[model samples]
Target chain A: MKYSWYRLDNSAIMYQMVLTPRAQSLFRMGVKLKSPVVPSALKCAVDKAFLRHPFFKSELKRGFFRPYLDENKLPFIIEEDDGVLLKLLDFSSNNRYLLRVSYFGNRFFIDYFHGLCDGTGALEFLKTVAFYYFDALGIPFPDKNILTLSSSPSEEETEDAFTKYYRKPELGKGINSMAGGQAFHVRGKNFSSTGYGLIQANVSTSALLDAAHRLNCSVTVFLTALILASVAEAHVKGVPKHNLTAFVPINLRKRFPSKTLGNFTVFAKIIIPKDCPLDFESLVPVVKKLLEEQLGEREVILKLGFTSLMSKMPLFKFMPLFIKGFISRIGRTLSTPKQTFILSNMGKIDIGENEVIDEFLFNLNCNKKTPDNVGVLSYGDKTLISFTRKIVSTEIERIFCKKLASLCGEVKVISNFREECNAL
Target chain B: MRCKNCNVEIACKSSVCPLCHKPLVSDGEVPFPTPATKKILMGKFSLAYLVIAVIANIVCITLNFVLTPKILWCVPVLVSFIYVYYFVSVTVLAKRGFHKRILGQALILTAIFAAIKLAIGGNHWIFISWLPAVYLVSDLLMLIFIFKKKNEASKYIATLLLLCIFGAIPCISAYVFDLSVKLPSIIATSVSAAIFIICLIVCRKTIIHELKKVFNL
Candidate 1:
């Protein structure tokens, strides 16, 4: 049967090509409510939200040239599975939803295939669902500031923003390129035997803000410096400290004026030299200075432009999916050791006038390469800093959280270690 | 109700907490409601497939009788139909499991090979030459489940051994049948054996662990 689909955009194509069984390109963005989530209410909320957002209603389909998102025919049911981190999306199954809604206790988590959308797109869908869910639960939500269900999906919402903003390739110029070098690799027993060791450390937003104020930097900058210091201290023998670079994703929406919900994000590397002292005071200034330099108009343009140029090239566009996938896999492996770890701070999301949402938590995927990742998000008074790792050693997470706890008094840490979800 | 262990509040009447699976006791209102059963479209697809297969088989049989009376071309058509039916019913229709699907594929391959041999009048060579090779490949796959630790090095060693066996069997059978494909078989066996020996030397520690697990020592 014929299905309506679109060519997988550049961001989406990379995810499809580089996915491995051991290292599925998957991440979880979650919401915790003040009260427990009602299953029927969540289903109702999902149904209403799905109608408003066209992206969530679609599934990935493998085409002759590349994979594309097709309209899903099966029921989009909310699952209650918590056995593994991000269960691979099986498109061949009767239900081919790219994103899965799973609930445990008061938490509702949405796991994405990375091909569907990025963190910003995911948060938009989650916010709408939370709005509808509270409304369905007899608790009315104010529509003034909340992202309520739209009557119709705007064409702009589903447009490929990369195509809209891509510029023609310049013949001769130095592209904004990150230096390739080995960084400190976190080594531990592979938790592939068990599942991913999930640890969420919740700190007071006010305390973090106060700490950031004292440091004269943003919360993300302060936290990134703290993480860098922790990793520097944990650095093993023989690894050069000069090569330590923390990979941070910079959302382009702040710079670019478009609401198109495909992947519109680029990465910046925070590099520190080996001779530099391993302390927060020493690293914070360097981080702030580098971030200022990296986020410059010229630098950001070149960084984003290079990716768009690659996708637009006829050579890459016409290459078979497997060949592209193979190249991407190799590229990821060679680049994986260049950075210490990936830290994504989705920033604050306002779940307006809804008393139900307690906080938002973000967690990155655990892969064979660069198995440990940190994700941060804040809502209301709580800022959840989550650590997702496939390694048995919690050294990095412990060091990072201990530093965070010192900065922000009384941090609450929770874990899913050795815990299994009860089957329904 | 709240889990004493995880400190997360539970909203179900079931004494066990859903998240950490710890026990809890307290009268708490059900959080939302149990989700309704999803309406899957598998039944509709199966019904349509069944209807198409039935009609096609009948039409093929009728065409065979009308087109050529002496040839009995319906035999091949019927064989293809059986293969499709077995694949759909065994693999697709049944509950999905990794081992179950592998077993189903093996059974289907065996049936297809047997049918082709019969259709070709006397190809005892298929059972002697190709079927064992296919079985050796499937057996390598089944070893994944049997060992439970799929990442172990010994499984790959067994896979390489089976690869060589796959090469050696065909060569031996070809010799018995006096066929002309001996040189290619020897090359396959030698290459597989060399790879296997290299892997054994490189991953000795991992292979030892795998062997211990297998022997239960």
Candidate 2:
């Protein structure tokens, strides 16, 4: 490995020592292939791809003060535990691999502990694995433009983008917009089992495309509006006339030029003022405008820089880890009320041209603080919306899917719920 | 295939939902990916600890030999080394089946400590007196914890009972060994036994419930 280890980036510190069973900080990306996935071919693909991205294969170790990643001799092995998806990872135990690859039928999914990488980095790794899987299947060479084990990893891919892109903060420009009243949280009976409830709503991409086009907005904005509307109806009950913000993670790799497979993402809040009559029609324009404004290079840079600068401070860096962990836990708790829910869109996954992959889906664990999360991803002609929640109620998902179905005239909702609890 | 119960599209070769384990009828949908092997290349933290410990012991032995071969101070070094190994293995490495592991650890520690005392020309009282007293206290605490139920009032009652018997060993040892400094042990045991009697009266119902849960009546 070129680098022994990098310090846990500012973006990842919030999740490091304060992890609970309820908040494992895990997310998954699954690929559904056209043909029955060959186990040997998949294994070969992983083994080959592992060489190119050895950073993901490294194990996390508890250092004297902070945690560091140590290189492991064994590659991250794939498990066939289809019984429970996104299972809790105990980093201290024998299973030190930060990543897990699981297979069911023609579906292959990689569950990543977020400390390893963000959605963008995880997606990039999975795309490469898919590329080699197709190659192992003796499929015709699709496209030459793809990341493979042959390509030597660059220093840029392993660079700490947060530190690299961090500019000295201007005195007056340091702004903290994390001021908001408590949100109307979604409450329900928790699952008897610790596993999250998943509702995978597969919408025709063309239908969603048309809806976004009509709204003069992107799919992400359109979906955010629908979610807000659904949450308002199903969970919030009544408008509290306060700031109900939806925290969206913007992948810095999109705006900045860094390919490190660690956390290089920052959050931007899209606030839906409680004063407004919350409706899909009105919220679409607001969400679109908010995203456009926050997605700017200058604003994101400042926000991310502020975080990076704080971590770089000598006083903050010198503080004992236990104290830092305590402060981080408190910060997380205080910040929870500001965000109504977390929505992450990996946008679209493209392995290569003429690939046999039929679809892709993304989902996240329901954290202790934020009990609900919606992950969006698209593959080919299908858009997979994974509504992962910790509670027994799927009212928000049902409402959101029903709204999308109303627009598209068809929507397929699949869930991991055992009981026909929430009747459609 | 789709699960009728969960309504989740099962990408499984089996005709059942992995989540709910409900039967599924094939709608001719393809399954998800399959892995090459179920076997994992497991990481060995314990093995790493063992290797480091072995290397350190070798270094200590070499230093002892270089200093003075006749004295062989490496013997105590070896005992201390083994104690460190037992500490890590019992506390850090093992996660499951703690009941057995903990008892095994207690036995090993007692044996190691007794051997050290004997080697240093201490009296047999180290084994007969000190070791048994410590073991008795630890074993009682362990049993209380092992029997304690989640969010139970009986745990507090058990704590009270443990406190009552706290000085029983010191007082008994003093009387049996015919020690002159028996005043401290007598006072401690009297106070403890008195408090224990008070708790047995005050927390009678809670103690009964705890006993029932522990004995599975």
Candidate 3:
């Protein structure tokens, strides 16, 4: 049966692995940031990264992992715009992924969707470009954090795992409709300043992996436990319990060849109920078990089934109106899940300090679309625990930076969401 | 599908109109034409927004298990409906969304949630209840549009609030009225149904009539 559901095409598929979802605010970067904005050196680094690893140009092999535009047949594959995707907002801050550039007074929106690459992979690419850009600018780049997200040695080896699963969309009962609708939250500009704080920690990818192994959890879970602990501590002022949906995006790379430069990640969600008496230590075992089981072959099969259903033939192509409506109605419920926030660990992005590629990938920043309510996470030689929040006070970023410094060895907090580029 | 802004008569399959840089137009119909040359989000945003609202209501079932407020958290739950209304009002259906419609949608959802959570108050069985009621609201809204004015969905906005406020009311009233230790499902359903019928009739005779007379409908 055909439905007037969202369809995709080659453009959606072309830069598939390169697409990254941005927070809506991030999208407005082009319109937001005051311009006279020149392309930053970070952008040049991006040009260079593309030099090393030109995006893998593969045809649409199957339905699952191919870059597919959302219901809106937007041309660009999704990726973060460095203009808004900055480590620190500077004059020449045209920090963007290879394709998406939202600088100046516009949204830092990477005019792409989430069919190309996962947050982890995209961050790797972004950091690589930034590393090169910063080194050239005479800014001392951090240690060469070797890229940890490994590609399957060969496409043939991963074919079975990739092919075994089908797209399976798990959702509640049907609300059959198609078409992108807008329900933008009206933020209160008049929101009185309430003291909220942020802190970023740089836990090396290796150390995080170690913690994950010891805790019997994925690096995501271990880091989540830590974040949860921190939140528990920070909100100790009669901590009002809040239900948190930690949005976790997972790359659907097993079925297809490596989408080395596309947005090809799906949101794998975890719900943490507020006020639940979860001891920090106890959560590790449960999270470890969940991670171990979730990545199994069966899980992928289930996920693929949902993906297949979602990728149902476009209603306008051949299916009758009634059939199309029926199928598309089902598709909508099949796509969404409940979660409060997104915490994706783009595992590790490495940049060598070699003279040729002096500074490769430097610091990490959340997608412009990533809300301050949201947290963009990654771990390499150092962990990047960044938050995208609305600032009510100058001390919010200051407090978070201080807190992060205490959590790990040497940590720096780059305050781009607010006034100045002051690092304490 | 041609480009909306420019006279560029590109392929029905093209995303960018050859002459003008404009989004491809769907001509306000489903079964949008898609060719290899162009990419279109064949799905309608309004429809997706609608679907999200219904599923979101079902997700509210988590409230039964998790510690949370019933009403306030319900506000966040209404975000989907707000989006749906926004789409339908501005884009798909093309009309100014009314406060009553928003209120109605919210109330219907809240009541569905309130009823379901109450049914399986403790046991895991409660989550199932929200789904059926959510389905009912969406289905009934669609069906009602057939009988009432152009958009009957708005007509029942008041009733929806009544449902949320008085959802448990019948039960409470039954207990208060000394109707019975256990009020019959038929009775509660019958009473609500009666009120709804009465409300629809009154609407047709009054506000709707006024709308027609006032706007020469």
The number of the candidate with the highest TM-score is 2
Put down candidate 3 lDDT per residue, A1-424, tens digits, no spaces: 1111122322233233222232111211111222222355545544554443333211121222232212111122333332223322121122222235333322223222233333544454455554555555676656454232233222222122222344434443211111112211212222122111233333455655665576556667865655544444443344334444444556666445553444444444454544454556765665556555556665544544444453344533334334544454565436442333455555543454433321112222232122233343442254555554443232323333343334333443322322211211
Across B69-162, the per-residue lDDT of candidate 2 in tens digits comes to 6665566667876777776766666664444454455556666654665555435455455545554554555445544532333445555455
DockQ-derived CAPRI band for the predicted complex in model 3: incorrect
> What docking tier does model 1 reach?
incorrect
lDDT of 1: 0.69
lDDT for each of the candidates? 0.69, 0.69, 0.39
TM-score of chain A of 1: 0.91
lDDT for position B121 in model 2: 42
Name the candidate, 2 or 3, with the larger TM-score value: 2
| Candidate 1 interface RMS | 14.6
In candidate 1, what are the lDDT values of residues B1-217, reduced to their tens digit?
6445544334345465443445667565433223233345657756787788789889977987898766656677777877776677777776665555665676567667656756654566675656555655655565545356434455456655544454355455556656554554454445545555666686687778655434323
Query: Distance from true position, residue A131, model 1, in Å?
Result: 0.9
| Candidate of highest DockQ | 2
Clashes of 3: 104
Candidate 1 C-alpha lDDT tens digits along A103-141: 877888888878888899888888788888887888877
Q: Score candidate 3 by lDDT.
A: 0.39
Model 3 residue runs over 4 Å out of place are A1-98, A101-117, A120-200, A203-216, A232-243, A254-257, A273-275, A313-337, A351-380, A391-410, A417-424, B1-217
